[model samples]
Target: MKITSDLKYLIIAVIAVFLVVNLSGCGENPTEMQNQPTPYELPDIPGFPKNLNIPADNPMTVEGVELGRYLFYDGRLAGSSHPDSMMTCATCHVQKNAFEAGIDNPRFPGGKTRGLPSAEYPEGKETPHYMLPLFNLVYNHNGYLWNGWVSEENQKLGSEAYGVPAEEPFNFRNLESLVWMTIEAPHEVNGDIEKSVRMIESIDKYPPMFEKAFGTPEVNIDRMSKAIAQFLRSIVSYNSKFHRYLRQEATLSEAELRGHNLFFSEEADCFHCHGGSILMTTNEYFNNAKDSVFNEERDRFVVTGDPLDIGAYKAPSLLNIELTAPYMHDGRFKNLDEVIDFYSEGLVYSEYVHPLMKNVREGGVQLSDQEKEDLKAFLLALTDHQMVNDPAYSKPSDLP
Candidate 1:
């Protein structure tokens, strides 16, 4: 039978439909899509609080933590592979120094951390403050950084200061934000995020790591930061002699016991700021009479713009205080003796001085030298030798 014009048109329509259906890939199998990465089970840490503040976007994963471990120690996190230009998160945070750059650091003397040499800051750039120890970070739900700048509620889409991508809003949430910030900060990595992503992607091993951790071989700052944050959160230090005493696994000496009492009593007034079960820090900002006058540009005022917050800084955890000397925000005190002496008789009253410092009017708590020695012994009990030498937190030997 001869086909008419109407029949011919119908045939053409059927052929077009078939072609479109096949080209659209509707026949492709679901197996071709990437498999979801396995969720990581976080270890139960002693004395840690029940409720954690992990971000909904980036849950912990074993592969992710492993990837973060490599990134945390690799100098390329700064977007450079050159030996002379190398700098990593580990650059300022050494494992032996309780993850803080201690005063004995030969490279950055006085425990003042510096980043890779940059044209804007030649001869390397020094961080405004001393490095905070990297332990019990998972407990820091209130915020990160000394001034409590990188907080949960304060995180936003982009900052001209950091050049965060606009499309990725709310990227800077929790410890993850710190990773990106450090990469861009002049006094930290002095790196560009786009460049960092590119450098990491170029590494043959990293793409597979990304796949294992994030279910894709793609590389980006978000993934990098999340992985690094995972590794950071995994760093817990609760095996100290003090922690052991609490667990009934060990005992403190007579002097240590006396110092412990003094630290928690009205006579010492240290527990109000540095006391807690899991972490020694209350994780709150305080002035602590560092100076009577404060610089609005510096101190907690820079972040909050609140006059009362002038000179206020985070009370760092004393978990590994012995290994983390010289102490304080600027690494001013050389040892525990100097630190105790300052608190004993060096407090200068200020309007913003934390009310916890009830003895500020008396210059300080005024502990006798003997008492000072006792206090030092107790603080030393907080040192966790195992944490400093933990093989898990160390740099991977395979990496060049």
Candidate 2:
């Protein structure tokens, strides 16, 4: 058993390797590799359709959603760490406003939000369109945003599909794609992805949270995007008085009941676009006679490349629609009364108008004042107070 020089050297090498492996925590207790994320259970909403459009690559998880909630509210997610320059998704999409920049939102005067200040631009750039609510997004299988630009199929299609310059990246295929776009967009965060990643990675608290969520301490744009998307998807709203009435747990007031009938009746004809048990929206695009002119590049026509789609926008959910005002893509209507008035008499004729607008020829449905009041009551019944005050969706108090 006497060791030769070669055998002795081999034994020493083995011992040294073992020591290094143990020191690096790669041996027995590999906690890093065991950092598996716990699956998040989506709430069971009554009467809502199932089979949500969650991506397989990035499944929902408790830790991931928690991390996303923090990032969703954190201004640091913007490309820079400076307080003045920092802007978060929550800046425009507040909980009180049904995740939209409400007409009264302090940060967004007249419900318009601008990004970081810049000397080059001088005047800060504002978002081209009004903010859309983020709740019940899991059900929007066709796409995200007003024009359905962020879609599952479009990710592979690239910018050419949308008629954008070939050189421009057409990476928008899902909600995750919005992260990078907002960071780089001059009107959003006015930031760079690399800088954002670096900033988050450098934060002492975030790396540990990232590890818990993704099983690695490494923080990157992809992980951040996935996390935020999860949080956004988890923001379901089905606890309204209307929802309770549907579940047989409560009863609607007489006014709300009358409004409900008016909304569904042929007189109002409101269920065509904004109907569905859980979502309150068909999630389809329509011109809706918002404007006769279809010049904006953000219109649905940009995505479809069809002239008929001009001035078309997605039919937003009526769930929490009462809180998310001013109504329409541009936030033109100041209140539900104005919205009802527009639908009553403000119908503009357009070749691209949705075929479902049966009363378009008559300008609008022309509901009586009493009927309009009832319809507004019905719309307000869809408002979920629980959604706006949910602690889970609020900003993490631990964050500075």
Candidate 3:
């Protein structure tokens, strides 16, 4: 094959096009493609529901996620005496206990020199409003917290959802500041979050993380949050005994199968609120199954000023519902049965109750004791024993 001038030029043109497509990524912005989260796969993630919504800026990658994971467990996010804060993301969300509060404790141990479950019950309400679990958050995006105050999707855009208004105009100068707030929030990591700004500015390890992840030495608030968000996006849990049964990889017992059917059926009415493969939330707002907020407006409403949005809270994912308890926004129901019974008998008939509520003011859906037991069995199936103690996610003892 003798190469003529025309043929050689043609070959070079084709190579150029291929290299362009490979480099800039199909003619679209590399950042745009990076922002979208990867979809959840089933055989791999048994209960895998769907791909999480990744913001255009905070794409998930192995190195970024690993750094975020370390930052998540690092108590330095929380403000303490130089480093004695003892409160990391794991501080409240204890990993072994399914990223929830400790046993016998209804809430996490930090926050609130004067905390209250609701403003109405201000006396000794020091317990946390809810101890958030770290499961399926990649699916929910910013829907992790109980009250759902900070509305960052995969942690970007702004706390103000598109149509939502920002009560405090300059609330977030950028995403990094908000990242600071997430850790600083007493309920979250009890410390001054901005302190991280000065420290990271001086540290060598953090600078490179920012450079590789965000392509800059300027690690602002949004960049910080984006890096943290990468680790969060990586913490998706879907494998479980029940999930395996669903995928036909494992055998489900007679009771487990029966419970499964009842879960989706109308008699249990559980499907309306706790439906889909995730088995708890559908990434929308709900007015509590049989629960209520003392001051509906004061809770999340303080953040999002929609009047009709009173008493509404994000639907929590049911991945590790067994371990993450006392349940509900107020932590009112102590156990699953108490939670079930609240739906069964204690549901307060109110105009504001979640329209999905089976036991809505229309006398609500009624489930017998046996049916309740069956539903509880189904909920237990959602638990993942492998996740609670994943060595990859446990605390790093070597870190000081």
Candidate 4:
């Protein structure tokens, strides 16, 4: 039978619609067509905690971590192209020093990190505190920094006073916030977010990396923060001699074993803050009686606003303590020996001193020279040589 004119037109229209739908997909945004990211899994480290503090919004991805490694080393991240103005996270957080500027670091003498030099402060503004090691931070739930200021519990938003708009991602919440904060802080990169973003976006190689990491070629401060944070979290240090000893894969020397006993014993009482888990830190804040007078306003009290926390600071993980020298928040101790001496017989008494320092009234644990040497030996056992030399954590030979 012959078809009606109306029926013939309807068939043509349907065919046209089908063709359009099929062709439209072929021209869709490359970002929309990108594959989902591969999830990054932590290595199964024996005796280490299984929980990680990764934010749901920013899941760990292999692509993200790789991109972060490049960004962490690229001096252009500071929004400057000049050689003199160049500064990156790795500038201060050298891998060899367990991500801290070592006391013997040729650049920053005594491990005191400083930001890019500006006319306001020609010598470069000194960082508020000594650098903390960047290992196994994925498991840290207590917070980041000596004062625990970069925390989820902190309600303060990024201030225009500091060059960033008051916003959600700008708050002191996680490793991501810490990245941008470092960029904006006067004592760090001392950069503008928009400027840095523009600089990164203009780089030819980064867009593809951005696409791989975030399913888009778009580069922004938020993505930068997340990528860097992912890289930071991926840094693990569970292969130290101490860890190997725990796994029964290695043996400690007699001196190291003796020091280990002293560390955990009530006589030395060094385990209260630095022990209890394989992480080697309770990750809690305490006033360790470093000084009788509290003057620095950047202590834990600044974050918690509690009087008792006046001079308190987060007990940093001691996994790479041997490498990360010029100890304490202010880099007060030049060497581990000085630190041990202070804890052994130089502890000053103060009401704010943590109760865990049981021998504070007696000026410390009062260990002998032999005991100090033994303790030093034990501390060295905690060093992870692999971490300091890991190629994955090192700066890429070629950066965009």
Candidate 5:
């Protein structure tokens, strides 16, 4: 039958309505669409690795990083509002010190960080090991901390005693796990996760920020962990003098150039673990013959359960090494000079000493005083002054 114009329009309208109703369910979830965060693109640093360790479940986002930065510096993150009682990631990880408590840190004398004082311990609990600088961590696939404990390779579930449920996100893996672990660790914030979550949820500023970041205003430990991890990953440090030299934007001094040659050459032998990458780390652990005995319960051996890993610890990235003083896993050396001296002449023999220490039999590399000074110049060239002074990584001035 031939349809009238009015009849044809009505039929078309009815069909359109039916299509809309049916297709709506098939489309992306409106709630999820609304919660979709803006993707945060990391800067394309020169000679830096493209493969970041960002988790698939928690992708980096502009909103997430902003929220993470706030959470990172918020002293109230410890579930406490009191000035004396509060603790934060920034309490120990100061940006000026390359996110490490510097040797001169008054709070942590000699750069040895400790948690807030508690009734059980009036002096406050000291961290098991010294702080590692928080930068270029996105490139670190070999695991984290001195012993490579919190890693994707690790299958250990979180402890029920600590309120961490045996779940996907709660497992000892990735930077997200590291965040929650820090909150509960006695030597860190020593905080209760539930209380921390409730406190953040009660805050006026966070819920909206959380919604912007993760699609909902519901503040949980998982989201908090993911957010903080994003911020930590965002802390890149590739703008050092050496990096500029690589980019042809700057040149090194005579001593720095000589030191650079020594560093990459077998004579100085620093490149075995700390060279060959812009990230400046092999991301592997080593027993660098600091002592003849191994008794530290938390050494790499504890993680691997291998006899060879008895005294092994991570060879940290040398980026901004100038600022991250009181060197080594235990903060044994107070300055670069001391570290250079140790590797130069103070190498202690150990049964578990890494084979990389070829000159261990001769006590050390045995460099001259002039060579030592030159080596330090090259190390200092790795310092990214821009990173430490960058306002973006700094604590928000208006934090509540």
Candidate 6:
């Protein structure tokens, strides 16, 4: 397992994570090779947390996070026909409900839909969108689902279903060709992207495991979408309990340090777009208040068709976010005191609000009920509990 052209020149600090996991030949060769790129000097990923993103054609290793946790619990490489009702990606990602993203919310496969996602249907077929829990999924900045429409140009690993845009889908170019037409997109793993590219062309150990996680031994369709985008770029997350009280190694009591000082004070300006060190958002997109899931919409007019992306999404990543609750972007607030009373006083004040959602109708972010239980005790100290029981992203111990 060694080819090292100085480790494929480690993609020179991940040239946009190898142009977002080598999106179709990462080429048009403009010549920038100061020795290819090597960013993952690597550490802290045990249950992941030191703010992870990695892409320069996928930089982290331990054999590409053990083959992206065996292609994230392989549903025989989800494109279809392998179905004995075996819909992998942990059949709606449940690592103890932290991977809660909904594939389509029929109260997710039955009931209780926080981030909705619970498939395994065949007896009647209805579930979708109840599965949005991939837990700070490598520091969430809009890529997965719930109208956020999958991101980073469907980071490779080839059954070919790639496309992304924030939210609003009543068939936008047939849901952007259902992200590379799910290769056999009869409707989510129904199967036939050329028989899922001939089921990885009769897998002889997946062509040197896609040439040892993609230096390229060849598989087709952008190296099988860069080996399922190198197993979802190895889903990273930070060590929580507010990152050991933001690395003072641990100490936040007193109502989670006064809800982490009114969430990085300036009187709750809430760290201007949920700032770095694993708040992991800030790619820029907001609408803050006024987001009743785009109620017959206008404003943040759905990801800047202008008219202000109406209720602009993607400001997630409060890490483990109190175990991914019934929050926003259509999950609708159920706690964190109704998400701090919708950021204190149901924010709707707009001209597309989010100037850190200021003075919501004049009395905003003023916060009470003891500062909304000190901002839900500083968002339950960004809960980590060893990345929700990391048996290396659980439920796949040689699955039966």
User: Weakest 10 consecutive residues, lDDT, candidate 5?
Assistant: 160-169
For model 6 the local lDDT of residue 28 reads 43
Candidate 4, 1-400: lDDT as tens digits: 9999999999999999999998898667655665568889889887788788999999999999999998999999998877887778998899998999898888788888887777877888889899899989999889899999888798888877686777878988999998888887778887767888998999899999999999889999899999999999999998899999999999999999999999999999888899979899999999998999999979999898988998999998888899999899988898899999999999988889889988998998999999999999999999999989999999999974
Between prediction 2 and prediction 6, the one with superior lDDT is: 2
Per-residue CA lDDT of model 2 for 1-400, tens digit only, reads 8889999999999999999988877655567557878999998776676888788988999999999999999888886677777887888889988999898988778888777777756667888888789999987797888999899768453333223343323268888878767776778777767788898898899999998999888898789989998999899999988888888998988989999888888888888888755578999998898677777889899999988889899999999998888878888888989999888988988888888877888989998888888888888899999999999999999886
Taken over the whole model, the C-alpha lDDT of each candidate is 0.84, 0.84, 0.60, 0.90, 0.91, 0.53
Q: Over the full model, what C-alpha lDDT does candidate 5 score relative to the true structure?
A: 0.91
Per-residue lDDT value at 208 in model 4: 91
Model 1, range 1-400, lDDT digits (tens) per residue? 9999999999999999999988677546444344556677666766677677678888988889899999999988777788887778998899999999888899888788887787888977888888789988887787788887778767466767766665563255588888888888888888878878888999899999998888778998889989999999888898999988998999999999999999989899899899955588889889998688775455777778888788888999999999898788877889888889889999999888888888889989999988998999999999999888988899999887
Clashes of 1: 1
Q: Root-mean-square deviation of each candidate, in angstroms? A: 8.4, 7.8, 6.6, 5.8, 3.6, 20.5
In candidate 5, which residue ranges exceed 4 Å CA deviation?
A: 1-28, 160-163
- Candidate 6 lDDT score relative to the true structure: 0.53
Stretches of candidate 6 off by over 4 Å are 1-135, 138-147, 151-216, 219-221, 224-230, 236-238, 242-252, 257-286, 289-311, 320-348, 351-359, 368-380, 383-400
> Where does model 4 exceed 4 Å of error?
1-34
TM-scores for the candidates? 0.89, 0.88, 0.74, 0.91, 0.93, 0.31
In Å, residue 279's CA in model 6 sits off its true spot by 12
| lDDT, candidate 3, at 177 | 35
C-alpha lDDT of candidate 1 relative to the true structure? 0.84
Our model 6 lands, by Cα RMSD against the true structure, at: 20.5
Q: Which candidate is the best by lDDT?
A: 5
Q: Which candidate is the best by TM-score?
A: 5
